[model samples]
Target: MNARRCDDLRLTGSGGANRVMEAELKRLVMRSAFDVRVPNPKREGDETLLYPFDARVAWVAACYHRTSSRISWDLCSSAAVRLEPLFEDLVPVLSSDDRLPGGPELRFSVEVGAASDFEASPLQLRGVVKNAIVEALASRGVTADIDSEAPDVVFIVRRAGTPEARRTVVGIDLGGSSRHRRGARVATGLAPLRETLAAQLIMLSRWDARTEPLVDPMTGSATIPIEAAGLAVGAAIRHPSELPWRRLAAFEGLPGETPDLFPGTAAKIVALDADGECIKAMVGNLRAAGLTGAAFDQSIVIGQQDVRRLTPERIEALLPEVRDMRPGVFCINPPYGVRIGGERGEHELLDLYDDMGRALARFSGWRAACFVANPKFVYAFGHHPTMTKPASNANLRGHFLTFQF
Candidate 1:
């Protein structure tokens, strides 16, 4: 049994990706004996701390940042910031935790956050702290190397209070690279959805492969189908062992492999797109994800068909492979004028959505989970979503609409 102190492990993600992140974490905690706490309303930093984390739970999430660091905030002169105390605070935690990388040469970077009124240059302050940290480690006979680009560790310094109560807070980044880059997405379109967001959308759809299959009509770059394929196969997509922190001697016994989430049979998924290029990309993505061979062909059907032109018969024709599977939900991110460089007129887009809605209406018992920036266009479907939730991507605000047929 691992006996190290259960420090709060922080996870970070894209700006609006935290809700699904929290929900995903909760599912993992429930599956295991590990203690996981998702803040009621996650804080502002796009980072959530999973307290008393079990290393085994890494399979469910691959956050933008993960860290066990000392948080010190202040409102003061940037030059007044000291580093010795911060590293001193981290040593105990890093040294005790066997999952982190140890170093004779430690690459690190510093991010400075200042109050609106502060005068000191963050660049200058970073230099000061960096020098102090190097000297501080040297004093203890611990050698260190600093690499600003792709640093093994990242330190964040933020201003907290007014000049009268001046202070700056610092935190070390634990997870080296964003866990969202799960390696499957090699090809992309003009506006490919982020993989993490795609996975989150799939989970939120609540489509079960056992009883119901998933359909992505707009499978741009095939992110949704690829992610679903990963989940269905119980493939350990996120390889935490590749993280720089894994080199730390302190993290001596951390598991290098992520266990499969699903075992036995794979899930049924249909990937469709109007662009033949996207269909090709989907196949390539699935291949990259090791979703090839006879089983993959039996489970996933990739084709090029315009969703607007889809009829129940045509849909069946296009997905004859999964025709008997009875698709449960249409989980998709439909095109918007602003994204993907809309080449068509506004009326054309509305008509397309209307046609899609009309075509889908025939399913009678299927469901829909559509993401769109403009809620007004939803009316074209002639049916309102049973529920709507807010979501964002690429800095564009949007809503996730769920409809029951």
Candidate 2:
């Protein structure tokens, strides 16, 4: 695509919070050397931010982003609610576009969401939209078929606005499976933290990743530690071949190589949990993410230990290299008392948070970030946080609080 055509392209990514995800995207755009035009923040209840498209944005989001769940290109939008006229308008555009995937059989999937003003059900609307697209492509001399199981391209058809002023949008999904699934942690312990949320905690904590030492005391399945290690080594979360962008002509000549597993300037990372099974799960997950042999020995240490018993002396004994290192990050996703056996009573969970705060206070100069679902954690910990960012963990809403000890 030429520069003017690129300007016509718009993209968006979905994640936990709009503000946090938008901030991360800005950082990624700057690091990738792409000029992006940021759209005004989405209105309340909106879950994504739109930006003028850059091929680098799509490539980096597919392979490197730890925040976005999925990214999509906004193909077209119209005030017309009818499917026929909307797709008919694309016939000329489709004919002239050389970037369209050229294969013997074009496998595709369609998703539809209709507003309350629409009379048709979602399933019926989806069928109408699918037929409209297939007919449109055939008119342009391009053959296409529906393959929901494994599709070369996934299209989204959505309707919005009030009855008087309705708008429909059509977009193509560039992210195939969610970006949060890093293909690691085959065994997730009870109430395990999602990898993307863990990455957000690490980013919010501002850990340098090179000189600092990271410690996760209540590291169930070691999600936070493993994500830290992955980020330090510049690991690609998704293989280049699996990305949907491979089918797009605009992404030609982009770097498709995954970096070798080398802990050149990686920081010292420690994972400690009270449960023995959690430790075993962490080991298997580390191996799955290619952190083994020399990489494991040089940068990571895993052990079973209760959070209350974690102290400066205990950490030094577990990983002696951290003794002289600079203060780093201490992040955790502790129990929320809603799920997971034991600590069902409110008092028991509060006591655990109290003990956790005391243990974390022992590490002078270290920065701490915790994800808590309960509102009482602030009072129980008895320490004012330096900053608190609203976030969500699964179905429950929570906050990520940062502290300096």
**TM-score of each model, in listed order:** 0.76, 0.85
lDDT per model, in order? Answer: 0.60, 0.71
Following a full C-alpha superposition, what root-mean-square deviation does model 2 have from the true structure?
4.3
Model 1: per-residue Cα lDDT over 1-405, one tens digit each: 111132334455544555666666565545433355444432444433333333434423442211111221111123234444433444443344334334566677776644334344666656655665566455555576778777776655555433465444444444444445667777877667777667767766877867677888888788888777665544554455555445444344655555664466557777889988777787787888777788677678887888876665766665566646464888888887674245467667778788888888887788888778766568887788887777676577787788888
After superposing candidate 2 on the true structure, give the runs of residues whose Cα lies further than 4 Å from its correct spot: 1-19, 22-47, 80-99, 112-121, 159-166, 260-263, 340-344
How does candidate 1 fare on TM-score?
0.76
Looking at model 1, report the run of 10 residues with the lowest lDDT sum.
Answer: 67-76
Q: The CA-based lDDT of model 2 is what?
A: 0.71
Off by over 4 Å in 1: 1-7, 15-19, 29-102, 111-129, 154-169, 314-327, 339-344
Highest lDDT model number: 2
Please write out the lDDT profile of model 2 over residues 1-405, one tens digit for every residue.
100111223223233456656676565545553465444443323355556666777666666667666566666555554545554544444445455666556888887744444456667667766776676577656689999998888877666434465556566776665557777888898778888889878887888877788889888877898888866665668767887665678788887765523337657888888998888888888888777687478588888889988888887787775658677789889898775456458788899989988988888998999888889998998789999877777667888899999
